[model samples]
Target: MVTKIRKSQRIHARIVVMDSDKEAVHQLMRLLGKEGYKVEAIEQINKMLEKIKNEQIDVLILAVEAWDNRGYELIPTIKKMNRFLPIIVTSADDSIETATRVREQGIFFYAIKPLDIKEIKLALKNALSKKFVSSGEALFIQKEEIQKAFDDEILDLADASKILKLSKPTVSKLVRNGELPASRIGNKWYLIRNQLLEWLRVTAAGNQRNYGTLILETMDEGVAVVDRRLKIVSCNSAYLQALDVPRDQIIGEYCYRVSHRSVVPCDESSCPVRQAFRTKRPVKFMHINYDSEGNEHYCDVIALPMKEKDGKVAHVVEIIRDNTETYNLNRHLNWIRSFFAHECRKTLGPIVMNISALVDENLSASISIERRDKMLLSSLCSLKFLHDMIRNYIISCKYETEKLQCNKKSVYVYKNIFPQIIEEFHPILSKKGMDIETEIKGERPIWCDPDFIKIAFSNLINNAVKYGTAKTKIVCWLKMTDDEFEFNILNEGVGIPHDKLYDIFNRFTRFGKLAISGTGLGLHVVKLIVEMHNGTLKAQSGYLIDNKPITYDEFYANENLYKMKDKNLRKFARFILKIPSGEDTQKMEV
Candidate 1:
């Protein structure tokens, strides 16, 4: 007709190529650009969804090998995002199964690798010109025709239940409750096939929403939904609890204002919610939030997008898990490591210097024999201290990681275990001018792991010798009760404060004197060992008054004990270990 085409009728299409192979993508892009079409290339699968959602893409060339052969899996989601967008899948796999699966996903074409450029061009031209029947539109058309046919087709409750995949009783109840479109005819409810199917679809959709709500409510992790405006749409109990905010105040509130108390939103790079909305993809990151009282909390946040029908992000579902306690524990562990390193260096520094001097012939010759012997003894003590510390640390780690198991057996604690432990510590006892006075009232072979018992008592005695006043007595009482084995070690030394007594057995806890060379794991390890044997450990430290053990609290309450002289007050610390000896003792053995 020789008529000019309208501006709106001009053919201008955009094509996106998703491929892991760079050279292939470049060649395709150049070919498409030369054909006077706008082309974009994406190498990462994560970026593909965002590009499709943000841009008006007419055709997509998806390489099956891209994202490790997971490219085809994206076809369904892509179709959901844009029903009319044509996807031409390219695969190196020439298997019929792959081609069939790709076609079943409703892709425009399946092109095998070593692709023909001319064929791809022709497919592109056809895809651009072809009219697409969206699934939603097709479903609507099918439902209209089905409804007309169903006008004459009637079904009873039993028949409707089969089609709905529901129990007959459920269908009857729905009919009784007027939930399903049905009518009573001759005492039996009858439903149209189309109406029954329609009712089932609506009910299933509602059930899905209920299931989602139930899941969100039951989860321990905080979950919340936020719209694009940064306003919270809904939240679970945990979400409210995490922020310590009232439920009434949380709904409809700006997420930034509620969580951060800030006027502006959080930075998109750090905020998972914002990033999910911006990228139209799932995001995960660590977030630091502040409570109502301005306390910092560490949280692991995962934000997933809830997309609209048009492939735009409508809301983000944020899952928050509180990691504040775990974070603090890790920080404390790192601090313990640093402290341990410092202790090792402090203990080794003098030993290294002493050894260097001993190695120097001139230095050794000039030193007195008595002084050299003292140095040797001091070095030996230091080495023993370091060795014990390391051993305790290893045992403590084993206990924490649940790798330590007690091999329990019936053993004589007083005769076999105590003697060896005493003999081992004889040198340290003599050096510290300490004497262990044992009052043995238990002669029975207790049911326990002998090696573990030895280690337990050794740690207790070592602790007594370390802090007990020089030349003071360490009184040990071993008694056998009808139901349990009782052992107590009372030493006159630095008394623990009332507050510090509560956490005395906690890992890496040290109090009273910081200058003492101890790993702080000795008592903790002793506690673990005692517990492993179905026993209990208790510590009491204070002065004695009226032949009764006065606790730190009593000492502080009484003005007389508070003002008493240090020498007369008689500060003492007693640790009691009691192991059950009843019938359950047999079960303690692993």
Candidate 2:
């Protein structure tokens, strides 16, 4: 509801609202109608001039999108037609140029959207009342206010005392103390109704109460407004946390001293605030700061300049937004780049050298069958490494761009995803003389993205082969529940340490003392694929450990989970995946 006040002019006022957005028009109409004002909504700005010319518009409410430049150009034309008509402008763009233009037009109020409804109502009320006061038309005021204005433009101290129902001596005292809006003309004090109302409002609300401190305190971004001297005039809670300082200790201190911990101002080339002041616009930069606990923090800082009278730079407002997550993500990406570059060189160099040897040996003398077979195997390994690198890189890029779409359907385990994985890993298992068991708990067909699920399963099986010991028993099983499908792969070997179970899913992770043939993104890509399907992957291993619940490998041989007398512990690692089913699984497929 609008803040109600006694109107000196009782007749209803007319308001015209112009906005291309249909919802904005309906909303403004509803709000204005509730306040007893007749609202005329206009959508087309080009036709607004003709429509408004005929209407007795007391206030014109205009909101313009940045792309609608023509709508903004019409502000002065409307004002020229009705000089006393108060125009309140609202813009989607909160840039300095928009604010400066509004100020230049002497707009009664200008707000940036998405604006609070209460703020818009207040701005409208202020614009209307300002017009009423300046024009003396009393379009939105009480009848008595008009009569009083006609009687005298400036009421004396005695008149003001009577109007306010206060003693003349008290009014004189308030005037003398600068508490009232009255000023002495030669020997007597006089006041205007506009000035008196403004003074009373300020006195009741307190001048500082209307400031943006409340908004700043509630914002998540760190905000600080500083003077030209770099002294902090106002700082929000986020800013206090950013600087790791108490409010009492920081309010009066220099900003450079607090933020940079320096005695002098910031470096000219690196200071966004100084740059903003110099450019008379907003300037942005990224920097690293540290918290009280000594952890480095990455932040993106934006500085906006405030201009004083005569268009001179006055103050600067700085906003800090944390980008630590993005910074770390980028670092991980760089690591991947380095690791991939090494893999490419390591894979390609061997193949090139082997090809050269084949040509030389074949041309110079008859090449032995043994040497030919060895060179062919080397090329195969090189091609496999290159293929895996390209595939993983493409998948990672797709995930990063949010373009990794999953086309899901009903997939038969025995017919679709399972047989291919078994066939692919059969060679590795055969070489190690390992045993593989396939077990099904329920129905065979499950709903999922068959292709990606195949990728995820193949990666897990390959991981087991690469890290698990030779001559081990590998178990692959599918267990169906009432609402979900579960897939499990377990192999007996030197398993992951309990402490590193979760960490193994991170990109570029390598475990154990053995050299593995991978760039370490296989498991990370598997994790991303599983998460995309709204599923979970858990890694578990059983090895020698004490009775501690976690069962880490750090325990001495004297512990219980290993063996009774022997310190040597056999290791087994398992990967479990749970994906929801029954309902429309297509929706679950990202």
Model 1 TM-score on a 0 to 1 scale: 0.50
Question: lDDT score, residue 239, model 1?
Answer: 79
lDDT by residue for model 1 over 54-104, one digit each (tens)? 445668999988766677876755654455567999988999988988898
After TM-score superposition, the amount by which residue 521's alpha carbon in candidate 1 deviates from its true location, in angstroms, is: 2.0
Model 2: per-residue lDDT, tens digit, 1-590? Answer: 33333343323566778777778778777876676667888665434554544445667878765225445666655554444557878777889977887768867778887767788777767666554545354544445544544432456688688877889999888777544655343356556656576656655686563366777788888888888877877778788776665564566578777775655776878899889888998999887766556677787878989787788887898887789889978986886787668877888888888777777855426768777767766676567557766677678768877999988777765567788878766645665677678888876456778888888887888778777778866788888655788889887677887788889888767774667667677888888888987999998876623422223443334355434335566677888888876465434432
- Model 2: what TM-score? 0.47
Clashes of 1: 0
Per-candidate Cα lDDT values, in order, are 0.76, 0.70
Query: What TM-score would each prediction reach against the true structure?
Result: 0.50, 0.47
**Candidate 2's error at 88, in angstroms?**
47
After superposition, the stretches of candidate 2 with alpha carbons farther than 4 Å from their true spots are: 1-224, 227-333, 355-371, 426-437, 441-443, 480-483, 512-514, 544-566, 583-590
